[model samples]
Target chain A: MASNTSDLRSPLARARGLGSAKDGTEHWWGQRLSAMALVPLTIWFVFGVIRHLGADYTAFHAWMKSPFSAVMMILTAVVTFHHAHAGLQVVIEDYVHVEWQKLALLIAVKFLSFALAAACVLAVAKIFIGA
Target chain B: MANGSGRPLSPHLQVYKLPLTAILSITHRITGVGLAVGTLLLTWWLVAAAVSPEAFARAQGFIGSGFGLLLMFGWSAALYYHLCNGIRHLVWDAGKSFELSDADRNNRIVLGAAAALTVLTWIVGLAVW
Candidate 1:
């Protein structure tokens, strides 16, 4: 009977590997969390952009000089990039079946996201600090 | 016995009715892709601002042109849609909205809020300009 197959395996073997893939939940949860963080942050950033629309360079600098706006902008940039990375990672994972290509893309996305986020934060800091 | 080869499967799109949820899901992917490209625009804007007034003006000119404005508007819409739907996903992640009625209600709310936010952003842009 087919029951013999189940009985042949150790209990540890049967219980240890019942899932599709390990550590997949982290990706799922991070994507969800970053998305959640982006909700209010994106809304705030949109209004911030609108408030600065038509502003001259000096005015734009002044607007970003505000501590609160600067902080929010940095946070928005980081969170948005992180959210984008998570979204794109899933897209790559689903569609890019080539092993090396997928791995390279995943790494490239992380690098770009981090670099952009860092640049945004530095720009915000410089704007605020007059550096 | 002679055997017959099976008929080719009909294409899925012919049979698949485009549902609201399906449409929204596809739009979410489109907006995600759009936003990814739009990030380059944001990076350019920031870098220009950081560089010099001349550079900033150049960036502004690009962003102010007809095509640029159209792209900006699209980006704004994408941003709003992604945001609202993202919140919807968050709620779903929390194990809520499993009921059909609640799911429908949440979908409507997401769509409506995205529209409202996009309109509001455009209005604010118009007012500013």
Candidate 2:
């Protein structure tokens, strides 16, 4: 019976494919990709911010309405938020060991980031379209 | 494993000596959080700019203040730090930094580049004004 038990367990475990948490590589890759995307986007963003330094509303509107600035602004928002989501995801996984809390935080981060990214894109679209 | 079997092991952070790489690791995390918060500020500015002249004025007023400028400066520094450190990580990922000396050199490079970038950004910012 003991031999049979061992044999049964071995096959079941092998079949189940139970293993160490293997999802980390995906998160790591995601963070890296987002970081890479942010490099150019961030440089553009910094320049955009600097240009707005002393400008008033009229200047701000004209800047955002420009095609190149509008496109870069949209890219910056999307990439920045995506990168933020990836980073915060890892943070939650690292510190929040409680299963339920970790799940909730992960979901909340995803939802909030998506909402912000979408809002920024829409706002930019509206500006370009004069809506 | 045999000694003090019932007691739990001390946490990782408390147990380890803080090395340069470890410090950079934590700073990477810190700057990431900072960038996330700063992104919200950017979003607010974009929304205001898109909405109306009054809204844009409000954003400009807040951003032009001393405190706002300070926060912006900090955000820019965080962005540059995270960028440099992230590239360091990518290099490490490609299996180039196994040697202790190489790791130390890369750490120094990342730190120095981040500082230089921050200074240059501020210089340009001030020049713009």
Assess chain B of each prediction and give its TM-score.
0.87, 0.86
TM-score of each: 0.83, 0.84
Instruction: Give the lowest summed-lDDT range of ten residues in model 2 chain A.
Output: A16-25
* C-alpha-based local distance difference test score of model 2: 0.84
Give every collision pair in model 1: none
Q: In candidate 1, which residue ranges exceed 4 Å CA deviation?
A: A1-24, B1-15
lDDT (tens digit, per residue) of candidate 1 on B1-129:
123457565447767787787789878888997898788888777777777778878888888899988999899888889888877777777888888788778779989998998898788789877
Provide the lowest-lDDT 10-residue window in model 1 chain A: A16-25
lDDT of 2 by residue, A1-131 (tens): 35565564556555665545734357677778877888888888878888779698778778878899889988888888888998899899999999999999999999999998988998888888888
How far off is each candidate at the interface, as Cα RMSD in Å?
A: 1.4, 1.2
lDDT of 2 by residue, B49-75 (tens): 778888878888888899988998898
Instruction: Report RMSD (Å) for each prediction in the order shown.
Output: 5.0, 5.8
TM-score of chain B of 1: 0.87
